[model samples]
Target chain A: MLEHVVNGLVLGGTYALVAMGLTIQYGIARIMNLSFGDTIIAACFATYVLFSVFAINPILALLIVGPTGYVFNLLIYRFIMKPLVARAPDEGALEVDSILVTFGLLFVIQGVLLVMFGGGYTSYSFLNSPVSMLGTVVAGNRLVALVLSLTFGAVLVGVLYRTRWGMILRAVATAPQSAPLFGIDTNRAARTAFAVGGALAATGGGVVSMFQTFTATAGVVFTMKALIVVILGGKGSVPGAIVAGLLLGLVETFVAAYIDPGLTLAAVYTVFLVLLLVRPNGLFGKA
Target chain B: MTMKTSHAFLLAAAVLALLAAAPLLIPDYWTGVLLGMTGYVTLATAWAMFSGPTRYVSLATVAFFGVGAYTVAVLNETLPYPLVLLCAGGIGMVMALIVGFSTLRLAGVYFVIFTFGLAELVRQTVSWWEVNITYTMGRYVFLPFEGRHIYWQLLALAAATFLISWGIGRSRIGLALKALGDDETVAAHAGVDVTRIKLLLFVISSTIITLVGAIQAPRWTYIEPSIVFNPTVSFMTLIMALLGGAMRLWGPLVGAIPLFLLFEWLSVSFPDHFSIILGLLFILIVFVMPEGVLAKIETLRKGSPK
Candidate 1:
């Protein structure tokens, strides 16, 4: 039971980290990025290449890959997504256009990854030593992943709640139309939020790569998990994501350990369905 | 009905009849390709029937389709073919009612994701059952179906889908659905029974989609949860319908044929790059013609310099 709890925390930490990226993009940028998981997978592969081929530590790789993700996402916002935003007649239209466009982006990124990495799973030895904790053993890599994710999550929360930049973002997210009245550049906030989300995704990927096996095509599964976490936690609530992500990880781990491993996906769906029925706007979502 | 509408229907009937006789005239290889085309035409048309008017993009086409196929696979040996088909439709209807009633209340992105999750749930459940209870992951479908027989059935399904779509387009429910799509709040205020209309169309659309899978299942000699409940089916169906201009009656047909042909060629010529190109095409379509090729053409014709 203790082992499962530790495993769940590690898994959930990564989930929370990735979902934070997704929630930021959706809430602030108002772009439901279907390609977000593929971006994460790209970061994983980049870290893999750095560690395996170049003999660089995955932790060190984060410094390179995270900023790369930010820059890449910034370019995507400027070139691909900006056009759709400009032409959209309203929020509804923007949402629809963004979904379709990012869906296409999902395929594009997946296809490129498939070409580069082949359709096979890849993992590398990082800090795989076993560490004892609470009379149970966990992998050193996973402990590091958990720590990295928790630290990042803390920094993100601190930035969002304690900083002026964070206030501007929150204001835009709270009221896009009214933010401009308060002298906020809604466009810049959106772009920055989107890029920060990308950086989080890359950071999450680097953390996950330290402990987890991943494939180029496995991006969709992560995308689905993050999406579920975001919805469960309430769309834009940071604390909600952390709590829900940990809870989901526990549920999945317990299900796999005690019940049937195959039922984990079913259990997730059951929770999602029941939650949606009970609270359509999510736990922390505004009506 | 107006004279123009009646005339259009008559012309459609004529074309479908000619296409029905196509297997006899064409080579075996071409018959196979046409079979694929007719199948997609049926699926895409059924997808657009509800999504076009309601703007609720359902990614559960494969969930219904897979249930229909699985129904036939499990019952074909014991039941007559027609009985199995009927069972498939019955199962499809129940599934649609359950899914539609449960998830249709959520709007926009929530609806889309919920439907997707529901489909994934169904797929995973079926997979678990097959693995643990049946001790088998796949089943062979031993039906006495020649390619031509499946082709003709698909053609018939395509024709029926088109007719039903056309009929619904002129019906009162269609206008209500259109209103709901435009703005659900206003539609409800205007006294449209929003839930009932959406549910009715959803059932009709899903049942037909289910039948498409049942009719086409025999073509695949082996059936499994992953094979039948592939998410790509849902995405492809949505893309095809949208590419053809879902709102237009003939839009799906126009989009299905050329895109089908392009996919066939792409898969054969650039097998490794197939997905890459498919992705690029999706981006291109959304960028250049978000309203679809048919709408783009219409705009160009009207906007031509005098």
Candidate 2:
């Protein structure tokens, strides 16, 4: 049980990272950003290519890929998101159009990746070391992922709470109409959020590559998990995403260990469904 | 009736006639492809009928399709084909009702996510149980069928789908669904019984999709969790429905034939790049013609004012 708990926490940390990225985009930009998964996959592939061709250490590759993800996301926002947001005259219509456009991006990215890389699983060994935790042997890669995730989360929380840019972002998220009056460039804020969100997602993907074999199509499953985390945590709620991510990780780990591995997704989704039914606003979300 | 409306009907009739006679003109492989396209049409139409007009996006269509496919596959081992097909559809309707009741309360993107999560849950459960139970059962049970039979089965299913869509298009429920799509809160306040109407449409649409799957499983001569429960199917169907003009009764059938043909062509020409092309097409359709090719044509026609 303790082992499961530890495992769950570690996994939850990874989920929290992904969820944080999703929360930023969903909260500030108000776009579903379905292509979030594509960024993750791209980061994974970038890491893979770096390792395969140059024999670069996975840790260094992650550092490089993470920033690439940020730039890619900025491009997506400028090319795809900015146009959609500008065109949509109302909130409801905006939501629909955003879903369609982001979903379109998801498809295009996944398809291009599949063509370029073929549907084959690839993985990288990062740690080559193992650590004992709670009377169980745990991977050093997972430990690295957990530490990085927590650090990233703390930095994000700090940035959101302490920084002027973060305050501007919050202002935009809360009241878009007032932001312009304050001379805040709302478009720049959105672009920054998208880039940061992408970086975080790529970092998560980099961590994932160290632990699991991945293919071009793996993004779909990752996207589903991120979606579940976001829903469970409450859309646009950062702290809520963190809490939900950890809880989901725990649930998935325990389910996989004791019940059945295949049912892990079912278990997570069941909890999400129940949560949506009972508290649509999420556990920590403001009504 | 207006001459314009009559012309549309005439065009539809001609298309139906062509579909009915397609097997005679096409090669055997092409005939099979057309049959597969018909199945996609049925699934796409059913999805559009419920979600498109009601403005409720469901990622669970593939789950319903899988349920129908599995039901038919399991039942056919012991029962007649027609009976299996009916039961498959019934199973799909029951599942849809349960899912709809549970998730329809959430609004907008919440509904989309919940439905998607539910579909994932179904998929995981199916994957877990499929191998063990099906393998054990395979020892004692089996079904016999040929490819050509699938053509007729799919054709009949397509006709039934068209009739259902036509019926819904002309029904009070259809009008209410449209209203709900336009504005859910207003429709609810106007005594639409929004939940009940949505649930009813969900059941009907899911059932039709399952019926299509029931026929399709035997036609393919195999069924698997991943293939039947693929989210790509749901996504592609959404694209097709949108591309043909959502809320248009015959849009899916019109959209799917050409889309499937394009898919086939792409797969043949560049197998690895097929998904890339399809994805690009999806993006193009949304960006360039959000209302769809047919809707664009209709708008132009209206602007011309004959």
Candidate 3:
């Protein structure tokens, strides 16, 4: 049971990082990139190659993978999102169009990765040793991941909440119409947020690849997982997303441990679906 | 603002007639491709009818499609195909009713997520039931129809879907939906039955999709949770709808041909890389013609200055 909690936290941390990135993108940028999963998967594959093939440490590979992801997402924002941002007259239209755009982008990225990697499962040989902790054994990579996820989550929350840049960002997110009145470079800020979201997502993905095996085809499931986290945590709340991610990771871990593996995802999502009817905003969500 | 339903009907009839005879006209290998295209055309057109009007992006393709497939999978031995089709449609309608009522009140993103999570629920349930009760990985299916018959059947399904979409595109309900899509609160204040319209359209679209899944299920030698409840198939249907442009009734059809052909060719030639190329195409579409091909054409025709 204690072991499940530890594992859940590790899973939760990963979920929080991924969902936090999504939350930032959606809450502030007013655009939800459905390709968040593919972005993670892309980073994971990159990590797999760097760590497994090139004999680099997975942590070190984050330096290479994270920036690449940031640039890639910035390009996505520039070419794809920027055009739509101008084209859509209202927030709702932008949401609808951006979802489609990201769906299209997901396929494109998945296709490229599938071509390059051939959809084979790849892994990073990292942190093989297990540490004994309170009658439960945890892998070295997962321990690193928990600390890293917490650290990054703190860094993001700190930046978003405690910093001056975060103040301008929050202004743009809450009232884009008035942000311009206040002389905030709303577009540039949004682009920067997206880049940051990408970097965070890649870092989380590299960590996850260190712990679990993944493939290009893993994109959709991961995407859904991230969506579940964000929804469970609330759409735009960073702390909410983090807490929700942890809750989901716990729920999933317990269910997997206690029930049939095949029944795990079905049970979790069905319950979440029903729960949505009662508290549509999620547990820690503003509503 | 555009063509009347009657005119669209006449145009559709001509196209359907040509499509009905397409197996004879096209090369033999392409018959399989044409058949698949019709399947996508059916799903995409119907999907657009519901989602396009409200601007609600539903990711629940497999949920409706699986209803029909699962209905047949479980009951094909006991029930006739016609009965199975009815039950499939009814099941899909009920599912949509339940899902819509629960989700329609939530924000737009909630709807998308719920629709997506729905497939996960259904797939896992079916697979679990299959393993525990059905005692099999998949069920063998034997439909008393040749390849061409199935081809025509799929074509007829596409034609029917197109007709319904065309009818809906011109109807008062369609106008209300477009109003709602433009601004839900205004539409509600304007006395449009927002929830009812969304629910009705959702049920209607899902029923047609359910029927298509049932019709297509028999062509497979074996049926399982994976094939019937394939999310990729659902997403591709949605993407194709967008790729064609969901605003107009005929947009998805316009989008279906190239997408289906490319999908078939790539899956056959470079199975792994085709999705990448398709994705590239999708991106190009969004970049070059975000409104869809038909919209792009209209812009060109009007010589609209950006």
Candidate topping lDDT: 1
Which candidate number maximizes DockQ?
Answer: 2
Name the 10 consecutive residues with the lowest summed lDDT in model 1 chain B: B111-120
lDDT of 1: 0.87
Model 3 C-alpha lDDT per residue in residues A130-191, reported as the tens digit of each score: 99987999999999989989998999899989999999888886778899998899999999
TM-score of every model versus the real structure: 0.97, 0.93, 0.92
Clashes in each model (backbone N, CA, C under 3 Å)? 0, 0, 1
Which lDDT value does model 2 have at B269? 90
Off by over 4 Å in 3: B1-30, B304-306
Tens-place lDDT digits, model 2, residues B37-142: 8778888888888877876767677777777777776677688767887788778878887778777766768767666555557766876786555542221214
**Which candidate do you rate higher for lDDT, 1 or 2?**
1
**Each candidate's DockQ:** 0.64, 0.65, 0.61
Candidate numbers sorted by lDDT from highest down: 1, 3, 2
What is the TM-score of candidate 3? Answer: 0.92
Q: In model 2, what is chain B's TM-score?
A: 0.88
Please list the Cα RMSD from the true structure of every candidate, rounded to 1 decimal place. Answer: 1.7, 2.6, 2.7
| Descending-TM-score candidate ranking | 1, 2, 3
Q: What tens-digit string does per-residue lDDT give for candidate 2 at A1-287? A: 88788879889988889888988888788788777887888888888888888999778887898898888888888888788888887777777777777777777788888877887887877785989876888889888878888888899888988999889888887787889899999888878987888999998888778777898877766777888788777776778788889999999999999988878887877787688778877887767
